[model samples]
Target: MKDNGSTKYDLLIERLCETFGALYQGVTIDKNWLCERFGIAERTAYRDLARLAHVLDEVSNGRFKLTANLLPSLHMGHLAEFANFAGVAHLFPHHDGQSLRKRMNNADNIAIHGASSRENQQYGDLMNSLDKAMTDRTEVTCFYRGKSRRLQPYRLINHYGLWYLAAVEQGRLKSFELARIAQFAATQIAFEPDASIIEELDTTSGIRFGKRTDVTLHVSAHAATFVTRRPLFPAQRLLKEHEDGSITIATAISDQNTLFRWLRYWLPDIRIVAPATLSTAFMKDLQARCEPTTSEQPQDA
Candidate 1:
């Protein structure tokens, strides 16, 4: 099959230009370097650079260098659009209108504006190593909760002020909290992750990658407004609007314990609508709690 080009080609060009900046004076790269860096054949390496041929000039028989600074200028124009999408353009402190325009015009101004999280501050190095492993498709070993385990990390997630790694351990997708990681190291062993596993994890909520349950809840009219305004879960959807002015919300809950906790918070305003077994368990728990204990027995002689 002849080549119609691929995103990998564009990515390779971008990575090369970014690594050895286009502004570098008399910088050159050889096909062998690209082959080693991108894990491609000599023919594949040359093919990947086909689209970037206009900006690159051949310095020698098998060597090439970027002859134009076209990429940075093109990337800079998308800064304002990206800032707007991120909703952090306003967070950038610009004293004057001109300064704001100038700062937003430069892509360097777009950054994660936040104080260092304690978890991130502590495990910053470990997280960096894990990120590198995930990017390179390398396996990692970490001691978590007194047990050492090997993992093929797929993705890193930050949810509710905690860092979690979604990884494949012993052929199962599991999530491990960074705080519980006692020791961490990236290994030289590389692994290819299945697209299905990554897609499943991406759609899943939080660090709970265990069995998921289809949970449904009913919210009273007053509380329904709040529920609709701010969904209980990221993937929560309104299944129906009841005639009694209530709303039926459905979400796939990975952890029933977590769902029960949330139910406790919305007590008077919300009720379980489906998964009768869970509803029964919750009622039994409530009944058990409400019943008088031996300690509350009458003290009268």
Candidate 2:
């Protein structure tokens, strides 16, 4: 049978897979051998080898094998491609594959400790549907926070182990926690994705979207060392170092809750310096927490 476009493409995929498997096992292959094995022209064989030239090196006049230095990267590239093909690549955030390979190779010398949000398998179908809608640029109607919302999904973002969907609702960009979304359904309505919204999503550091408020903070000497070691806030910047080892920092926050959470974590060491209203509000909240509620009050004996 004559090879059609689909047949040719399938043949190419099969050839590439076999070639990758051979090279991964340290088996040497030659252009002539590939042509004979695949029953393809010499030019096509050359082109196939050329596609992998970056990771292959000639061992002899006609034999080529995978370059030792690129083996780990090649392995990671293969896995990434397979994951993309399986449509599950979005489950993990993008990372340097070579670095990941190196880390795995030296696993004995490394230990990672961090917290991640709990996973619910029930959301698997929702995620798949959302992925298709985002890819097709289709509108979706989902119940968020017990309210029906119409959204134009843009990107599924994973921030600090939590999953969120960055989408446009009522012409405003917002981040909806994936765990909170319910009654998900793709609408027949198709919408053109806005370039500016996509650009904002790419540029924004965290899940919080839209206009932000600039908040300046004072890091006490007690927390200055840790604060100087790394940024703990969104769009954090070092403004000045005080003579007493304290530091002044500035950060932009689109949500007050986000700032409040950080402030609560670093309490007694970090304080809002510029925005008096926010400081007052945080202080009142702290006081409220410290005070006993009616339910916690001592009852008449």
Candidate 3:
């Protein structure tokens, strides 16, 4: 069941969208119309209408409509960007601005195509709610990975098309994937935002922010060309370029799995130069994946 506070806000947004849509179609609305349609008291309707006074114009006594340039002048680029980032444009009310949304979707060039965008839509709502909690400096309680957690959402990050929240849970900083969150709701408790948390989020990759480990990688000249063309991460630094067409790059890695993925992506051209254990683990994982399983064997019929 939706909470009353959330329901009320959603209803208000719905009514506001309807009113704006009517005004855009040259149909004026009055207080009585809103009250009757939404089954709200006159005073409540007036208050709701007043909330939109900045964009609404009173054409006649108690009758209101949007300004002539309201829709055309409305800037939806930023909101569209958010929708694209969260992949939740479908969750937005269709009656709000169907044509405008269509245009925005078609023109969205920031979201990389072929990235995994078709995740569950509820994740988008979860991400947006977490973002709101962060902005409001409120806490959120949710069941993540079968454990209940109260999180002070500090920073929201979009890394390589995945969304993560850097939060303080149980007095420790951690990163949680938006998709893994279940049963999330904001609490009344508020806390101060930590700058170090935000800085850590900006420097980390994906859900990897904890104790830093200095790791280095050596890439062949052919791969170096590609690596230098695009930074693996903002903190990544080129330590040396060897004459034998190999370059050494270094960065602080927090998650070994993340490094494994990066190495696998540039296999044969990249090798771990430090942290022997991480390199061995990467090689073992690669071999395990490449080795054929018994299930693949052909049985005599």
Candidate 4:
């Protein structure tokens, strides 16, 4: 069947513009470049550019162009001279108020303004992945660095303040922490996610964020009573109590941030037992902070 002329033209123009986005002044795009990049004819490329090359040259002044992912080996200006270019300067617009430091700090906040800002890179990545997963039902293989495993992503879950991934690689279902993940690339593999995934997430995951990992911590009266007195999170429940006032507190979470901060307040009372990851991080941070630091003298004084 013959190709549709309009569709072909649109495709050709799209290819040409994408190439133009990466072109720089010194580098001239030729027939061979078009063949290497798009495997199209020189005639087709020239035809596509006939209507637009003049405008592009006028705008770019022959400097590097092309917004395509690939970049040619043309030399961009040095770091100092980079800011001198109009195009580079437009990439960073000047704001009226707000210091740069304040802007940078806002970008770093994981949950800014209480709504979990997009400024946080990790939060953005996870939210994007979760959104894609929920909408597309695409299978993902993540290099999850949770204490349990590495480089495996079969699920998406968030806990208290942490992130988690669940997997059923073998027949066994397991949970992993998001902070442990190194990176992830969504796989084209499709799946019909099991209902158990949600069930385990709800049960094993904490009451708040759905991190499907839990620990039954051993506690003495100080912790048991304090838990009864104030409570760290609603997910924390008093499981059993010994006649000696000792108790087993079932607290679920993805990472140690919650337990560590809470136990730090408890000092010697609460003892974490089940999840070793939380325990290790807590001890490591505690050790580092406890080692006293040297004092510095003011030179001006």
Q: Write the per-residue lDDT of candidate 2 for residues 208-272, one digit (tens) a residue.
A: 89887889999999999998786788888999999999999999888888888888899889999
Q: In model 1, what lDDT does residue 105 have? A: 69
**Clash pairs (backbone) in predicted model 3:** none
Query: Model 3 compared with the native: what TM-score?
Result: 0.57
TM-score of 2: 0.66
Residues 150-247, model 4: lDDT tens digits: 22234565444455556554445566555555556666666666676667655653423344467877888756776777566546788888888888
Q: Model 3 over residues 1-301: C-alpha lDDT tens digits? A: 9999999899888988877766665556788888888898999888878887888788988887777677554444344555666656664454234454675677764453445543556576787787788789999999999899988988877655677778998767887888788788889899987888778776665676678888888889888888898687436899998998889999888777877887888888989888888788888999999988999978999
Per model, how many backbone clashes are there? 0, 0, 0, 16
Deviation in Å, model 4, residue 154 alpha carbon: 7.0
lDDT of 3 at 249: 92
lDDT of 1 by residue, 184-250 (tens): 8778998987888878886886777766788788899989888997677647998999888888888
Give the Å shift of residue 109 in candidate 3: 13
- Which candidate order results from sorting by lDDT in descending order? 2, 3, 1, 4
Q: Rate the local accuracy (lDDT) of all candidates.
A: 0.75, 0.84, 0.77, 0.58
- Give the poorly placed runs of model 2, Cα more than 4 Å off: 1-74, 77-99, 295-301
| Deviating ranges (above 4 Å) for candidate 1 | 1-119, 288-301
Root-mean-square deviation of candidate 1: 12.7
* TM-score against truth, every candidate: 0.62, 0.66, 0.57, 0.34
State the weakest 10-residue window (summed lDDT) of model 3: 91-100
